[model samples]
Target chain A: MQHKQTVIDIRNLSYSYVNEETSNRVSVLHDVSFSVSECEFVSIVGPSGCGKSTILKLIAKLLDNNHRNIGIDRSKMSFVFQDFALFPWLNVRENIGFGLKMKSLDKKSLDIVVNEKILEVGLSGSEHKYPHELSGGMKQRVGIARALAMSPSILLMDEPFSSLDMLTAEKLRIDLLNIWTKYKMTVVMVTHLIDEAVEMSDRVIVFGPRPTIVKKVCEISLPRPRDKRSKEYFDLCDLISKEIL
Target chain B: MSRIILGFHLTKKRKHIFTTSFVLISIAVIFSYIIIISGDNAGQLINSLMLSLFRLVSAYAISLVVATIVAIFISNSRFGDMMIPIFDLLQNIPSFALIPLFIYWFGYTNIMTIIFAATSILWPILFYVLHSLKTVRRELDDAAKIFGAVGIKRVLYFLMPVAFPSLVTGSIVGFSIGWEAIIGVEIIGLASGIGQFLNTPVGNNNNQILGISALLIIVFLINRLIWMPLLRKSQLYAA
Candidate 1:
């Protein structure tokens, strides 16, 4: 098999969250290192409070970098947050075009781009509706559309579907994979759901409890349209879960 | 969509448009008439009042700009973190205490009146802006950074919009304080203003009470026509 090009490389990354009130530093990630290849769907899964989300933020360069070595070939990245992070004041169309507007795109081009993404994300009729007017699933769809509008090489998602109902999550996951296939971008997702990690990712990087370390990296050899009930799929889920437990 | 009519949310689309237009036209007509027709006595009083109001509005605008800029800088810097307590201490010093120095520097002119009112307006606006800036969600900030929102663009797009509700709230409080401060400055410094009308008789014997009534009406009109609309408009941006 031909080796894929590495898009991200992290070496000896260590981080701690400082409690403002107490001035106490709680180590979250410790000497953590991982690599992501171009166009690969990778999920970081672990027990709750294992700093799975912290790893994503570190990769996105959201946190301060005084304590770690992290490298990425891509200059820009986009995020789909758990809470959907849609601006409450902006309607669907405006929310989707936020990044493009920040880049100072012309009004005509911005309108075209925003409209295209809104349609692509299945929020066509809801363009005029505010975040408060949308259902949870629709809100996440808008969030995903906003991230995609930037056309980043790497997409970072922190618990993107954790807030949705089971059926909604399942549906969104399938739709997301379809979008991923079309877009052909590198995706790094942080999730607590082992089955989700196994189902969606080409590779699953498991994390241990804080201070977190990479416990295991599991490759899912299951074919596309993975069956959740299949022995191979369940086995992979079991393996990743065991590493966390 | 619902629209505001007579301070109530009206559901009928057609009626809302009609009412909104009527309200806008009526306000414009009333203000225009007030500006155009004034007898010599009423005209002088109106001119002084208008001048005082213009000073307050201009000073308030300046306060907004300065407070937002200072708040953004301080909220983003470590040095600023240490200075917040010192800032709180500075705010506690009475604004009137600065009036003596202002009078000495600017000499009881319109500049002094404006500066004094601005000082009164500045702290609440600054503190509220700082609080809003500090409380902005980590996710939103990260989102902004990841998407290349920086410098003035960042302030205009992310910071200001997120801090808008606080800004409006702070402005309401600041304007109230500004009104009081301006009146005090005019009365003390012997500058001509609406406050001066209150101290002396207008047109006839013992019209001081009438002047006070006019003052109350002007305050009510300003609050109704300007601040209330601004507050309502700001609700669209408020989180």
Candidate 2:
């Protein structure tokens, strides 16, 4: 097998939040390090409040990096938020084209790109609907479409489907995996669901409770079209779940 | 079927236009009758009212610009932490109390009246926008930055739209207070305006009633025509 080049590298990344009232530092991630290879789908799994999302933020530089040794092309990254943070005032088309517009893409190309993304995400015929008018599933589709509109080299998702119902989440998970396969872009997701981590990602990076550090990096060697009922799938899920528990 | 739907829309639109025209014509007839009945005082009342309207509008415009700039400047900054309390303290000081100082400086001039009115109008808008910007959701802010909305782009695309609904509400509150401030300053110090017109010794009760009625009409028209439409439109900005 050919060795894929590392697209994202982080070494000894530490982060803390300062409590305003007491001026005390609360540690979130301590000496956490992981690297993602090109076109790899990786999920960071941990217990609640275990700083899994913080790791994504640190990678995206949404929070201050504080001179930490993190490496990635910031401009080549796009984020899909957990809450589907589509601009409320803008409709689906405008929401998807947001990053493209920010890049000052001309109207013709912007429309073309936006239209293609809308279709790809199965949001056809809802082009003019606002975020408030969308269901949780549809909203996440918009969020994913928005991220894809950037044609990013790396997609960072922070609990993209956690807000949806299980059925919607399941459908969306499959759709997202299809998109990941089609685009062949590196995707780093923060999710709490062990089965989801096993079902979708090429590798699962399990995190311990705060201050979070890497507990395990389990490679999912399951072949394409993975069956959730298969013993191998269940065993992989249990193996990853045990690290968090 | 499309033609029928279009025809229905046309009929609804026609009915709206007809109702609006009828109301406007009725107002014009009543206004003309008042002018004729009031005789020469009509011209004086009209002039004073126009002056007061101009002063109020100028003050409101200035307040809107200044409030937006100030709120955007201090929001999410440590400086905001210090200055917000100071601003709160300043807003609490009776706006009318500052009229004496304005009068001493500008000497009952239009500039003084406008400046005085602006003091009253600025606080509500500034505080409202500040609160809106400060309370924006963390994920939205992150998404904005992640999507390359930084610096002026952030202000124009992200911050401004986020603050829009609050800005409209603040402007409505600010405009109401502005009317009071403009009228009070005019009544206290200025030589001309509807406030001065009302304050002047009239020959009879009828003219005083006419002046008050005109003021009420102008205020009502402004609220109905401008602020109401804007308030309705601002609903679109709500997240």
Q: Please give, for residues B88-113, the per-residue lDDT of candidate 2 as tens digits.
A: 99999999989889998989799999
DockQ of each: 0.55, 0.84
lDDT digits (tens) for residues A1-245 of candidate 2: 99999999999988899989999999999998889999999999999999998889888988886755798887789999999988998999999999998999999999999999999999999999988899999999999999999999899999998999999999999999999999899999999888888889999999999898999999999997799999999999888888889
Q: Give Cα-based local distance difference scores for all models.
A: 0.84, 0.90
Docking class of 2: high
- DockQ, prediction 1: 0.55
How big a share of the true inter-chain contacts is recovered in candidate 2? Answer: 0.89
Q: Give the top-scoring candidate (lDDT).
A: 2
- lDDT per residue for candidate 1 within A1-245, as digits (tens), equals 98989888888899897899999999998999989999999999988898888778878777776634878854667889999887777899988998899889999999998888888889988999988889999999999999999888899999999999999999999999999999889999999888899999999999888899999999998999998889999889888888998
| Model 1 lDDT on a 0 to 1 scale | 0.84
| TM per candidate | 0.91, 0.95
RMSD of 1: 3.6
